[model samples]
Target: MHWSDRYVGQDYVADEADCAVLACSVAREVLGLDIQLPGERRPGPFGRGALIQQHQADFARRVDEPADAQPVLLIARGRAQHIGVMCRLVGEWWVLHADEGAGSVLRQRLREMARQGYQVEGYYQWL
Candidate 1:
């Protein structure tokens, strides 16, 4: 199955299918790696420290340049809270993620999100 098949139409549940979970799930599927997220099922921030720690241990290395199908983490309020897979649709860079505001999985143009003040904290490749 393709990575996008995991939860393409799934609605975003606070702890269930949030941005991080969606990203991690796709990464797991595409890269065939094991990623264990915290058991807490809350909608708020997943704590920057914990996220950084997990990424350090699991992801291969920090990527300065993101390519299509790469996993990326987004920062909000100085905390890493959102994540998605980088993709190109219609010759523009987009991110496929479980958007809480949208209440479902959707693809948004990366540049548009940045213009709207979304901070891309880091990008990493699955190990």
Candidate 2:
């Protein structure tokens, strides 16, 4: 079974299933890759930022336009605070994330998120 399939409808927990955890969960479950993230094991946005920066070579930064199903990291208020898997369903690009606000894993339109002021710091392809 696909790892993503396991997370559909799953709820989000701040320190347990937050953005970073969700992203890493996908990596471990789907790709069989284990990434060690820093910051007391429950790192926040800044910690995630450091993790991305440290492993920059393992990712190809997205610079052009956004695409579907790409792993992305988002920034809010100039801090890297969110991460998710990009997905396209029903002809719309959505972010599959463990939303803190919604308190669950949900899919939100990429455009709408951007309109709400969340900046796509960058998207990355695992290498």
Which numbered prediction scores highest in TM-score against the true structure?
1
- Give TM-scores for every candidate, taking all chains together and pairing residue i with residue i: 0.74, 0.70
Compute the lDDT of residue 116 as modeled in candidate 2: 58
Cα lDDT tens digits, model 2, 53-108, are: 66656544654655554578788657766778877667677777887767888777
User: Which residue segments of model 2 deviate by more than 4 Å?
Assistant: 1-6, 30-39, 42-69
lDDT (tens digit, per residue) of candidate 1 on 75-119: 766676677888756767777888777799877788877764568
Error of 1 at 96 (Å): 1.1
Q: Against the unseen true structure, what C-alpha lDDT does each candidate score?
A: 0.70, 0.69
Task: Please give the lDDT score at residue 101 for candidate 2.
Answer: 69
